[model samples]
Target chain A: MTVTPHELLAQMASTFRHEIGPAVDEPFAKTQAFMAAVILSKLAGQLQAAEADAQAAGDERRAVVAALRARLGSACPARLGDALTDLGHDGSDAAWSRLVGSLYAERDGLGADEFDALLGVVRSALRARLDRALAYAS
Target chain B: MTDAAAPVETRIAGYLAGKLGADDLRLRDVQRIAVGWSHETWLLDASWTADGVQHERGFCVRRDPGNALLREMSDLGVQFDVLRALEATPVPTPRAYFFEPGVDVLGAPFLVMEKVAGVCPSPWGSDGRRFYEAAAGRGVLPGSFTDALVAIHNVDWRAAGLDFLGVPALGTDFAAREIAKWRSLIDATGIQPDPVLTDLICWLEANVPSTDRLVLVHGAYRTGNLLIDDDRVSAVLDWETEVIGDPMYDVAYVLSELNRERTELLSNIVERDAFRRRYEQGTGIEIDDDACRYYQLLYAMRSAAFWMSATGLFASGRNTDLRLARTAWSIPVVLDNAARALGY
Candidate 1:
């Protein structure tokens, strides 16, 4: 659900392209196998992910960000406000990670209770992501 | 480049011949055994004649493939020295021998040591679980396991000249240095920094514990890392992560549920209470639960770093092993653990 599945599929496709296709005795068959691998990978990337998963994940991310911002109040630091903006705009995991870093960096100004409250938001989001991750994990 | 080619056994034999001062030397049972994730370990018997006396000795050759998970930390030469230092101690280990740094003799930098006789059963596997269960039922192995850890902690690292391991200053320096070590590994890898991991690292850094005692910590002290024979710990293996730090780091490892698979027995062998009693009695050092807790959290960060490094190695094409690629899944799994540990 996170980065694992896509990376796994890419690695598998690479193994097929680099090792499996190269092992073919006939040059024509090897070239064809390599071509098929590349085409199949491109197809799998767009087709593998369900629309339902993205929508559910987006809802969770939005809820986590909203709760965090609400806890920060209107007088929250500009850095945190901008981080949430980048997170919503880009919708990238890196954005979430940066928000986390920003929170820790601003912890001293936020004080103990506020910092803990904000951390709780990230923790809940992490657990939700972990629930999806367990599907790929052994 | 003769050593780099197909038959590595011949090269190893020729190298051993010169070292042993033997006119005719041969290697038997030269089979590679996957001892740990980092090093290429081969168990073999070297037979030869020196001074008109024939002899055969079991030797384990550990070679650094250069792309190992802990390649940045594990040193074969240092390991050889550590083994040599431990020869006078009660701790059971493979006797240190020749350590060759150059690739002229072997395909890679390899160290040959006296291979202690024992079988290391994987505590993570079902069959291995059954083996430990039976051994625990017999009741001696559990005590032996505890005693082995006790002996390791009891080692006078200063007297033994283990200070080359870079001792951290008293107090928070030990914990801080450890966090830096694992953090550096995470930084070196091109893996994405998961926020959960970032939070965990932040927590670990904010709460570095002070140590009262500094002893030789095995870093990974558990059933799988220990060699068992005759229901006793014949030797402790996997010295790659060994360090001169608080012994609680190793104790935290044994206390971890990661070593036990669906079992009540700690490390699938020793009972926690008995282990504590024997360990405390043997070492005259009380097990600090607080320190253990902090170290456990540090372990979570280290685990993430390890998996990230493994996946990074595969991703960078440094190593093409599918197993390394498979570890990409462990990043989330370990973060799941770290979050749970943090009560998230």
Candidate 2:
């Protein structure tokens, strides 16, 4: 852990691509080695931004969930309301995912206007998250 | 893993000799082809002497790699059976020969079939796109692509002994079944929940479309799955995901933008109007636009399931193929597409 993780990844990638890849004889095996090197290089490039992005995304998700819950109020399905409450103020990625699933799964029985309103609110937040993700991924 | 000292060639020759009833069977020039993510395909030349006559043939042996991309869903035996059933039809397929389901034979199940001679251009890579671009101008390949898919959709799967693949009964069973199938695979991944995927699944379940007609559906019908020879579709390969479902499932695949790159042409091979006209005329079934749209979303979900399973396999150390590791990036990319498809 002492060495910069990105530097270590860059070195490993270089070894795989420049040294180990050339020595592999089998075509498929050779492709695997080179592809592993490419993935490592990608990891090296993305390492610096990963933690900060996760934190930011978490904050945005909690805000969105709170806004949606206030709008739902007593209309919220008991199961979904409980799931969201369990995530507390700072929701993990997996919990957010589960909450989304719960929300959609409960959408059918809701009145058309209520469902549309809920969807609009959720979609806006989803789009925001997606934009940030795409930017980071690029 | 196979015994390296004896060689796969020796093992193959031995297997063929027992089945062929010839002691002098010879396997020549065995080479593993780097295609098919789920199965290992080996191309080899086989020769034998029987009744004082020499017989030679080229064969492809597809073996289960134990931890393939879609290991839980695909079966080598089922593929063999499907090929056997299709042999009597006009559907372009390689003739499957021997099938072994037990892992005792070569440490895994495998199926030996006639190696259809053709080139399967990858739909993703630049060179593959160029191959289709050139072939599109030639005119013959595009027509052949349309005709081959039509042949598959026109087949009477029930009469052809393909009922072994369960038939989805009445109304929206087909759509529901497909969603359930993929959901099972998602559950198998044992990864953290994906909210977008869960929402997509709910949406799919809520809006299941009614199936007007059922036929033999090639689950992943596209430019990459077809084998081309002499500028014509020589064979339709990759029967692993074939199912008895709505014809629109296959149509949606051809219609999806995933198969095309920098080209307005469908599958980067045929013009859209041309493909639609030919398919409608050949199959005599009007293109149901709504049904196709629904199946397109289903395809997106299926694609997401594939990436999740692939990434999970790598993370769990079930398999170390770099392709699986690389799929980790594809998971979000596909989920993003699915989210857009759901209008989120």
Candidate 3:
């Protein structure tokens, strides 16, 4: 009874191909329809995995902060240490939802350079956590 | 838009008359073949009567489109320059005749070039086995695809007169440059968080390997991009992404794809040790394993990032190339491979 975004996209794509696509005179309209289907399929796949992946990523980030605290001992910079401590405590789904929301809100405000720096920080934290996990498992 | 009948053809004919240094030149049977994401390619028939003889020719015009991904390289003159220089080399490229960089002629930068007749392998085509078979069956190509790649790498960059092109600063520090460029591309597109890709990029940066060897790298060299006839490469097309950087990047690109296919033909085509030895023999450069692995991982990451950016572009309506939208689905697969290469 309820149609999600993924289902709606698929329905629209099917309608376009069956109803509007045949009447279009554009040379590449058929190719465009096929491509739209491909994209819809990918979106469907992403919708299936996005929530689980986000949760896993948040847990992974928290683990990295704990490992960083252990590795830094007492020499870690005060600002970075404080940020890590804060991130470590706020590993709940609510925090992740808020972070995602804030990112969307600030998406246009952040320039390319600033966004890259932010991504770099997040990536570094994730990498450090992955390394710690590998070492522990090994 | 000009009338589809005689007026537009006559205008184009007039433009060519000036360039051809002849009178009574005319264009006939002009039709739009396909509009590429970057350029609009059209097939046209041209004829002119000079010195009591009639001459007819079939040629192609590649003109820039609005909001292309490679805006900086949109100048047909630059493409012409590269293709002209490559004429004397073993590299397979289309022969360029005239390059018009100004909008005064056709409202956009355009080039007239000799069209090579061949079937281009589609990366998204479902018939993967057929595609690989056709490529492998090109008898003129070397038994080892690496040999052809070695020939490309061994090209004299200085002799090619590309020094003026200004190689990237990351040429000397390839790993750093590779990471930075892709990161910049991702940032520019402003896509949503792709956790798998983000994780892979982090893994690649941390696992950077040390090496000093540098060679000409075809940024997107792979089976799909090459034109094969009679089991040999007739020509290597798509120089838009060419750069002088880590040679391992190209090698890793081929190897990573071949690894995915896992076919006996590909396996037998180039044994790891023999391929390296042959490449060194041909190019006089030794292959570095650690650096190759690092670049191989980098190539995968670059592919993932590029696909993500393309997806974002289409989704946001900045560009609406169906090919880019289709390619976005492969980003996860590429990221997974990059992660595997990084031993994550």
Candidate 4:
């Protein structure tokens, strides 16, 4: 009885092609209808996995920031770490946006050495989380 | 969509006729042909009487679509000018005849160029061997593709009198700049989140490699983009992505695509090691492994992002080409490869 993501995507793709594509008058518009269908298909695959992946990534990101904060003591910017920590707990869309934005902001503010150190930690954490998520899903 | 007369083609022929100082200029056989990703191309049969002499010629005219991925660099006149200037150089490019940047001529900017006859490796073709064989046999692909690339690198940009092109100076941080540029483009397009692509981009930025040498980077150098003939590269087509930066960008691109197909070829048209060795031998330029790996991953990621953007454009109803829409499906695969290359 349950409609899978794949099924939903297939339905959407067919609907877009048959119902929407033919109705489009402009060449560019017709192209968009087709692309939308393709993107929807891609998004379907991501949707099946992204939520769990993001949750795991959120946990790891928070852990990395906590460790960096501990090492740097008071000198470490509390704002970015705090934002990541909040995102880890609430797991809200706004929190995720803020977390990503803070990381980017910190990257811009900090020197390459400091930025890379932080980024390396973030990348390592994300990769570990992604691996875990993939393992769990499989 | 009208069949009467492709207005754009007629206008282009009219402009070319004026430039050639001829009367009774007619653009016949203006058949719309599909080529390249961004432009509407037409092959026209042009004829006129000059000094009581009748001359007919076949040429191509390309006009900009309303929306293009390379919109910032959509000045067809600039591309035409580059071709015009490069005609004197060893780099084989079509001879541009007329470049009209104004909208008055064709409802958009267009250019007319002498259409060189050759088989461009079609990406959609099934027979890879035939394509490579034809490319190698026609001398369209050099003994090593890398050698041809180095030849492009060896071109004295100064002697070409192309200072006006404002080729970016190569820097140690060239890879970083490139990463930032593509990232910005992805961000600007505001396409939906692609987690795999995002992860790949993050990985690439984190692992920026050192540059060993500086040379002209053909932003897009792959098998499908080149026109080949009789075992030699007749002409290198599509210079829209040409820039002055790390030479490894082009090297990495060619190596990644040609490596798989090289095994099947009789003469080893483009083996990765042989290509690199030949390039270094010919140009006295050393190849850097770390830089090559970085740029190879970068090329994959950049290509994926570009395709994503194209898909976005098509999805948003801004550009409608069935091929463009279909090609979007391949971006994720490329992104997956990029992620693997980056050890993600």
Question: Each prediction's interface RMSD?
Answer: 5.9, 2.5, 10.7, 7.4
lDDT of 2 at A25: 100
* Candidate 1: clashing pairs of residues: none
Error of 4 at B74 (Å): 4.3
* lDDT digits (tens) for residues B14-110 of candidate 1: 7788889997998888888873357988899989999999999999989998888889888899888899999999999989899999887676788
Candidate 1, position A82, lDDT: 88
Query: Once superposed on the true structure, which residue ranges of model 2 sit more than 4 Å away at CA?
Result: A1-4, A7-30, A136-138, B1-5
The prediction achieving the highest TM-score against the true structure is 2
What is candidate 2's TM-score against the reference? 0.93
Which ten-residue region of model 4 chain A has the weakest summed lDDT? A129-138
- The regions of model 4 sitting more than 4 angstroms off are A1-76, A89-138, B1-6, B133-147, B167-170, B192-214, B257-269, B321-332
Model 3, residue B250: distance off in Å is 2.1
Per-residue error (Å), model 2, residue B283: 0.6
| lDDT of each residue in A21-123, candidate 3, tens digit only | 6766786877687666656655655565557666776777776566656654676555555655666777543343233333333434555565455444555
User: Residue by residue across B1-344, what tens digits does model 3's lDDT show?
Assistant: 32234454565677676767659887666877546566677767788876778878766687776556654433567777877877777777777888877776667677887666554555445465566655555533334466668778887877987655446554346677668877887777766545545555655665566556556677777665666555666667666767677777777665555343545443223445556677778787766666767777777767766677777767778777787767655665565555555444
lDDT of 4 by residue, B1-344 (tens): 12235556556766777777788888777778664367778877888888899988888788887677665544687778778778887776778888777676777777788777666655434576566765555654656465567668887767776556654544547777788778877776666535455656656666677665556566777666665655556667777777667777876766665234535432234545666678888778777777777787887767776777776777787876655666555665675566556555
Best by DockQ: 2
**Model 1 CAPRI rating:** acceptable
Tens digits of per-residue lDDT for model 2, B204-285 = 9889999878899999988888889999888899887888989999999899888898999899999988999999999998
**Cα deviation of B33, candidate 3, in Å:** 5.1
Rank all candidate structures by their lDDT, best first, as comma-separated numbers: 1, 2, 4, 3
